[model samples]
Target: MNTIDEALGAVVAAGDLAGAVGLVWRGGAAQVAAVGWRDMEAGLPMHRDSLFRIASMSKPIVSAAAMTMLQERRFALEDPISRVAPEFLAMRVLRDPDGPLDDTTPADRQITFEDLLTHRAGLTQAGFHSGPIDAAHREALGPDLDSPLSPDAWISGLASLPLVGQPGASFTYGRSTDLLGLLLARMEGATLEEVLRHRVFEPLGMSDTGFSVPPDKRHRRAGLYGFDMTGKLKKIDAPPGGVALPERPGDMEFASGGAGLWSTADDYLAFARMFVDPSVKLLSPETLALMTTNRLTDPQRLGAEMFGMPTFGTGSGFGLGVSVVLDPATAQVMRGKGGVGTVGWPGAYGGWWQADPTNGSVAILLMHNMLELEQLTAGYGLGGYGAIMEFHALATA
Candidate 1:
């Protein structure tokens, strides 16, 4: 059997990655491998504790926090979010998702909490659409991460745009969780960071996870890297389209619950443990069951598209915050492999984690596999996905 180090080292040597941290824990035993460099140019080695911009992986954490609130009877799943964020009360829906922004109709119904959780709120990211709607999203939501708008301003801006579909109609992946996080903050009368800290991080002992890296820990942060047009690894100070900034602004008020988070391998493992282990007790078993179970209808699953590919159907389903694996045989790479109820959500920056309840196991691979629009169009910067698949295969074996 190949060791984790040897398995991941091969990827680094192939120039597919600068470095990564891989971990697998099962039955009270753990295997951890830190391979390659945190910064190839700086000669810093990847460490188990090295911080990473976990991107959309932040979704699961925020969802869990929201679940905790649910358990407290703070709000019901069916409650309309308009009760708290009234900006959505009289929203419009785009007649055609890709058509002119002015061609719209009033929203058929109010968006509910569950709609946001399941990504059926009709909200969408700028990159998901083309033409007028896409431009509208970019103008409103500055970047996917570290937006300059305050939470209130951001919510108003998002509500001003027309939804891609009627609320609860179909799955349209977008800024739902980001809205959820801001709502959670509003409900708690605190910043999103404080709400998460009190609700999730502190309880899970995830000391290294947060929206920003403090000055003292700056050296431990991994430098972002991506592939150029030729498929060679290149350090990216700032990615195109402003998806992320090289340095997070100190006064930045936007805390993107969808894509903004920095965490390390062990800290995220602490978070993932709750899904597989009942003893962790982040939520009541009843609430946890609600969260991990598949929520999408068959049509919604089939209609959903992510990064221009069918998101579900093919042995997978989506729950509240995580993707549930229904069949390992035909599951897509993004869904990953595990038992019927295995749950995971991968980040855009090459971070992946899965918790298999049947096996009582967790597996994680964290890397900075940033890709630009042109690289994605040319399919030139996806070797890191291969690294993730290889790591999962080795970890399971």
Candidate 2:
């Protein structure tokens, strides 16, 4: 288990993982290991180029694209998002996050580009709330990964909902990035797919990264996998909570800027390199510095929670689009552990990565570790995370 192959191989052998592709880049070199099956029932092997639904991992790339727009003087961080999409101009806030939607207050201020990037726009996901708000979100937004509504319809639906908190007050992880994506598309007068393809993917050489897989490349895609209640590996189509779909509808016009994007281990490594290596040149040094700097206050960091646990704790902080490690020794594995400036945003589908500037290194693990919310709450399908911890620990060793 000293090497990444042996470490991940053990997880696969133990039935904790179906397959994964792990890569560690350091000292101007890379070490990669592809282990287990892409589809166990079909006996398909995992490869470095096997495509995966990167889920929330899509945030950083979309955030980077927004930053690029900033560099071009397209808009200022302080500008209200309503400037581009006026639907958000007259937004309301819930009196209590879990209270009735009708008990509300006017938003303190309009949401800004910074709010969307930092997830402080007061928007939230259904899972974070317990009352009418959750049901309201599910009815309006449909799924987090792929939505059936057109971009304009989706924006209107989201705007109709009440905010969960005051603008710029705290971190509420939800559809802020999805809104940001649509806003970007509106600004460019193009689809989000076009905007990202032209601005982010093309410039970065991320050919394989996009909202949908073309017919020619479908065979390289990984089949979704999850653990049964008994903790056995099982192939899954649509898991509970609507975090992902077995296959994105061919006609879906909505691109999830937050949780939607298919990519590979090497392709994401290329994107991760931009943060640690200045020579990659995707952003100006000053802009990159601003993007990676911690934006959350002490109270905000302490107050933010995901899955009923303090998200940043005392060891890490939230940046514009990624989590920054303040102290590796105390940072939780969910946020990852590394040097003070290490930054990464893990995806819900078991994808994780980190770029450590102190050591000039990057590590990535891509796998389809989907689990139902019930399974997650019952603690029935967490072996995937353990496998990720092992891969990351050994990859960065």
Candidate 3:
């Protein structure tokens, strides 16, 4: 697995992965590679331009957009979110995480911009856990990936549910960023796509990045793949139609900040460059500094652990939307490449990327294969199977 083809082929031959596109940039040089098929059934070879449902990779981008809004004096991080989204004006907290729905208490205060940025807004996903709160989330907000409701309807549904914890309390990984997207749109009086395009995508020159793929670019869209019960690679679905994140007519109106965008290795590399290169100026120096730094309190770090997601490691903490590595020694537990102060996040669909501020390096691995959420929480996929550890480790070396 020393060469890119060999590395990707090993996984393809192993029956776990169908295709991969990876890029590593460091010290003003870049190495890009691709192997296997974007669609095995259709005999489509994977290319550097192949688009993948970047899942939570969308977080850092949306977070950057929010920072731009902050620079424009749209809203401060501490301002109550109710200023933009009135749905959150009066909110309730669950008395117990697993208790009945009616058992609740008044929130100590309204959720603020800072709370959503740090993921301490008491929001949580439904499918990852069990209990009444989880059920309520599923019934109200729909799945983590695709929801059938429009933006307004989705917020209406979310407003009806009780929060798992108090706002600005513990880190609960749910739809906080998605809610942020809606709020940003409301503030701009435009669609989420319009705001992100003007704020982040266009400036970064991410032409192929958006909530949905158009018809002409459909061929470049990687087919979603997953393992069958026998552990063999099975084609799941195609872009603009996958079950986890379908792109029907009205669905594009949501433009979820948490997990809605599709992008290529090169497109995301441009976005990653902003973190390490001051000249890129994708964000102001001070805002970028604050974003890459660890903003999590001690208790919030503990809550991140409870989620059991691979995006965070022992000595790492959540920043605005990305994970900040405070201690490289403890962060090595994830077996991915990075040093102290490295900032990045992984997508749900087997994508891993990191920008190492200390070393001036960026590594991105994009693939369409899906992994079980439990497997990801245990840190068994990206570095372990997709050779991301090897790819990124060699780049940094």
Candidate 4:
């Protein structure tokens, strides 16, 4: 059998990756592999504790915090979110997604907690879509990370925009989670960072995970990278103009739920493990089940497929904050091999993790290369994904 170490070593030698931290915990044992460099310029080796700007991976953690509140009866899933966020009480929908911003109609109903959790609130990413609605999103929300606006300002801006669809009508994957993060913070009368620390991070013993890396820990942080036009790995000089690295911590006040977290592979493994084992006790079995179960309908599921996620074709659907496999056979068509019940989501910065309740299995692969359009099309990012799949396949081989 090929060892995980050999596979990781091969990837590093090929220059497809600068460094990585891979962890696979199955049965009664946990195996970890670290390779290449966390800081190639300084010749620093990647360590198990190396920190990463885990964009989008922040969703599951924030969702877990919301679940903790849900268990306490703070809010019901069916409760109209307008009960707290009155800004969304009277909302508008775009008559044409690509039409003039003023061409709109009233929403069918108020957005609810379930609508936010399931990404059916008709919100879409301004960064991903191209239209007047997208333009409004950029103007209202600013960027995805490290927003210069306060939470109050951010929410006010977002509320002023028109939704892409009526509430609970379809899946729009842009900013629902980010809004959820703020809503969770508002529910607690604290910042998103404070709420997550109290509810999720502290209990899980994820000491190093947080919204930003302090000055002292900056050395342990991996530099973000992306493939150049020549297909060579290079440090990202300036992460696209409007987008921000919210996890890095700066003058920004908004803790974006959609993307804003810095963590190590081990820290995330601990988070993923909770889904497989109730002993972690982050949430009750029922709440955890709600998170991992498929929460999207057929059309909603099809909406995600349009984004070009390979796994979407294989019967995958969105859960609360992660992706769930509805058909194991179809899901196996992806580079990674997970069981029918596997649930986890990947970060835009070449990070992936999965938890399979069937075998008490958890696997995480962490890297810093940003997934660009050209790179994904050329299978450059899949080089790391293929390794993760190989690790899973090796476990059963």
Question: Pairs clashing in candidate 1?
Answer: none
Q: Please identify which of the two predictions, 1 or 3, would achieve the higher lDDT against the true structure.
A: 1
RMSD to the true structure for each prediction, in A, is: 1.3, 1.3, 2.8, 2.3
TM-score of 3: 0.92
The alpha-carbon lDDT assigned to residue 286 of candidate 2 equals 90
Backbone clashes in each candidate structure, one number apiece? 0, 0, 0, 1
In candidate 2, stretches whose alpha carbon ends up further than 4 angstroms from where it belongs are: none
| Cα lDDT of model 3 by residue, 1-397, tens digit | 4576577677767665778887888888888778788999989999989999898899989999999988878899899998887888999988887788899999999999989998889877776457787767767766555677778888888888888889987878888999999889888889888998999889989899988889899889888886555455677654322335445454446667898888999899989999888778878888888787788776667546445554455678878888888878677523234688788888767788889888898888888757666545554344335466666656666
lDDT per prediction? 0.89, 0.89, 0.79, 0.79
75: Cα error in model 4, Å: 0.6
Q: Which stretches of candidate 1 lie over 4 Å from their true place?
A: none
RMSD of 3: 2.8
Worst 10 residues of 3 by lDDT: 238-247
Worst 10 residues of 4 by lDDT: 305-314
TM-score of each: 0.98, 0.97, 0.92, 0.93
Give the Cα error of residue 240 in candidate 3, in Å. Answer: 14
Candidate 4 lDDT tens digits, 36-152:
888888899988889988887888888888889989999998998888798888999989877788999999899999888878898887755668777777777777787778898
